[model samples]
Target: MTSPTPQAPVRRPTAADGFVVVDKPQGWTSHDVVGRLRRLAGTRKVGHAGTLDPMATGVLVLGIGKATRLLTYVVGADKDYDATVRLGVATTTDDAEGQVLSVAGPGAVEGVDRPALDAAVADLTGDIQQVPTSVSAIKVDGKRAYALARAGESVELRARPVTVSRFEVLAVRQVTATVADGGPDVPVVDIDVRVTVSSGTYVRALARDLGAALGTGGHLTALRRTRVGGYDLAGARTLDELEKQADADGTLATLPMAEAARATFPVRELDEDEVRALGYGQWVAPSGRPEVVAAISPSGELVALLEDTRRRGDDLARPVLVLAAH
Candidate 1:
């Protein structure tokens, strides 16, 4: 008689290197997503490119393993968001989460017509100086502005120049609603807008400024990020999906680091000897790409991220981050 023995299934490696586009759910802090991914990925090396407010949702870029070093570039990339700005009321934080600061008078929203809105949006377009809301993540005096604001301290953030690449108004609707602002109910105007701004720009502040320009108070009622640089919602996966993937297979899907680098920066291939030399922390010749470039080996592996720097009066390729030895 012949007997067969069952064998254990092979476990795939969990230590991965690449990016994960997350469709972050509302009410979850950016740090919450990072911590959850760390547990799911079975590594504490996970990091995010940018932070999203707890009320916002959509594309949140995460880096695992060696890709964590590339988050700087992603963090500075252009961003897109779909937001709703209520023009009849203002808030302490310039967002819905804060207490009502002031409310516009009756019939105040009627003056905010399409022409007026367009002109105000145009004023905000191009390069403009903007002061972030006091309840923001900006650091002041070695402490977070929000922390200070929450502790009953006045947080006065300085105005910084930021670019509003696009401020497209998708739709606008005026709604009359009741309010509990320690007074009788009043009419309100809510404007739906989509904005594309520079990395440091604040969409909530835009709503506040727009209301101020229109003689009505403003606050962001809703916000959802749709894109970050080249990454968008199309490539993003929700947290539930990630957990399901982990349950099905003891690993979460991640974009290959080499492929992610190729998609992000200019590629510069290295010969057999060059890849090996860089593996030993040696520098290569000028890549001619000027800024950072992905140094790929002949086998198509991302050896490192290289940048040209003036050393010894010569433009030489220096490793910005060494991802692999060979």
Candidate 2:
């Protein structure tokens, strides 16, 4: 009699099981949430999608256990934010955290008209090159730019291409301010805007660039992320709620990988034979469909992420990330 197929040893849970969409609180770093989850989930494999600065608050995507594999796909997705940009004052870091670099007196921006603001915002729409804030996470000579800046070093970063598909000014408010230089006149306008942009686009940079365009200088006063891909703050729970839930039930709420994937990508089911072929990393004949990644399944269970590949003049589909065997 043939011996039964040996079973693969079950791997220990390493806190990398599934994903959790947390409504991150302001003043907490992404790493802080990871540390809290590490203790709560009882595993050390927690990871997050995009990093939200301590001053910003909103949906923060996190991965646990095998779900960590999903982060690679999540991080590149488009992001959305609602922000408040204050004019008349420019800061060193481009946000409220930095020291005031320059201040214009009252009436500096008094005559600025709505049409001018609209045109300036329009110029920022669509594809454009943006210079990131000096205090960003970008690396400079193997050191984080923020770290270098903290050490009193001069930081200069190059511009990168980013797309701002939507930049709509929702409201505007004017405020008079006293300049640190004791200037007689200082008039500022606070513009509230909602933006939808490609990944890596900096909203702080937008405020700075917009100020430069208006010739009055501007800095971001408040920033909040509303969405990343299909994940949104609407479906996210605050860390405090998560902690309370864990205390009450001994389990943390998590979005299953399949559900999260479906929210982010198109689904493509596979039959038993196809699942078997994918188990060994083999390619199946393509269905002539055009999707970068398809959620392949067998018997109603997620199996892998498949993409079309051309081999020997035959269109074949191969696995990019395999989740389970046949």
Candidate 3:
């Protein structure tokens, strides 16, 4: 009898090194999403670009493996949101997840007309100082603001400048609804808005300010992020889809590092010598522009993210982050 030949072992897929845009579901905190992705990507190196409230949903950009280093750049990108601001009621957290703090008088919400609402929203637009929501992740004296707020401690946060580039009212509806569990039905004006704001601008605060301007207590009823910088929901995938893909393939797909960088920053192609210099941690000739750029090698790999770090007489293209292995 002849001996049977041994078979080669099948290789399972591993973690990909790039970005993954997740369509975050409501009730999952940004950290929760990160934890879930850590499992799906089969790597604990996952990180998110921005924090999203647990009650809010939509575009949440996550980076896996070596791509985690790129998240710092993405964190400062502008964001777009679609939200429903409920007038005639206010909450402790400035959103539906908080306890009901106050309710407006009868007919208060109905009294707000289109012109008045538009004027109120306009006041919130442009450069303005805003106090972040009390229940926020902001650190105060080494403690998170939300932790103190939840512990019955008063948190006084300083007002910071933020820009609201677009505050468009998409729809307005008057309805009777409960803003909290086991709460009395209240008449409220729900204004659906699409807002584009600079990074760090709080949409919850916008709703609160808008309500205060209209003489009706207000809070965010619902919020969904639609875009983050050049990335949008168009490229986002649900967690369910990711799980199935990971289960079948043992890995999830991701936006390539070079492609993501090109979509975000100006491209600067490097020659063989320059690429070699970057690999050796040496500065190269400046790219003339002061802004950061994605430096690509001849073979189309993202060699490094460079910035013009030269002073008056000195010339150098400094590597902000080197993406390629040496």
Ranking by TM-score: 3, 1, 2
Point out where model 1 deviates above 4 Å: 1-15, 181-184
Q: Where in model 3 is the C-alpha error above 4 Å?
A: 1-12, 179-184
TM-score of each: 0.92, 0.90, 0.93
Best by TM-score: 3
Candidate 3 yields a Cα-based lDDT of: 0.91
User: Which 10 consecutive residues of model 1 have the lowest summed lDDT?
Assistant: 7-16
What local lDDT score does residue 228 receive in model 3, on the 0 to 100 scale? 94
Report the C-alpha lDDT of model 3 over 143-256, residue by residue, as the tens digit.
999999999999999999999999999999988987667967878999999999999999999999999999998999899999999899999999999888877876788898
Q: Which model, 1 or 3, shows the larger TM-score?
A: 3
| Candidate ranking (lDDT, best to worst) | 3, 1, 2
Model 1 C-alpha lDDT per residue in residues 79-142, reported as the tens digit of each score: 9999999998998889989988888887788777889989999999989999998988999999
Better of 2 and 3 by TM-score: 3
Cα shift from native, residue 125, model 3 (Å): 0.5
What's the lDDT of the predicted structure labeled candidate 2? 0.85
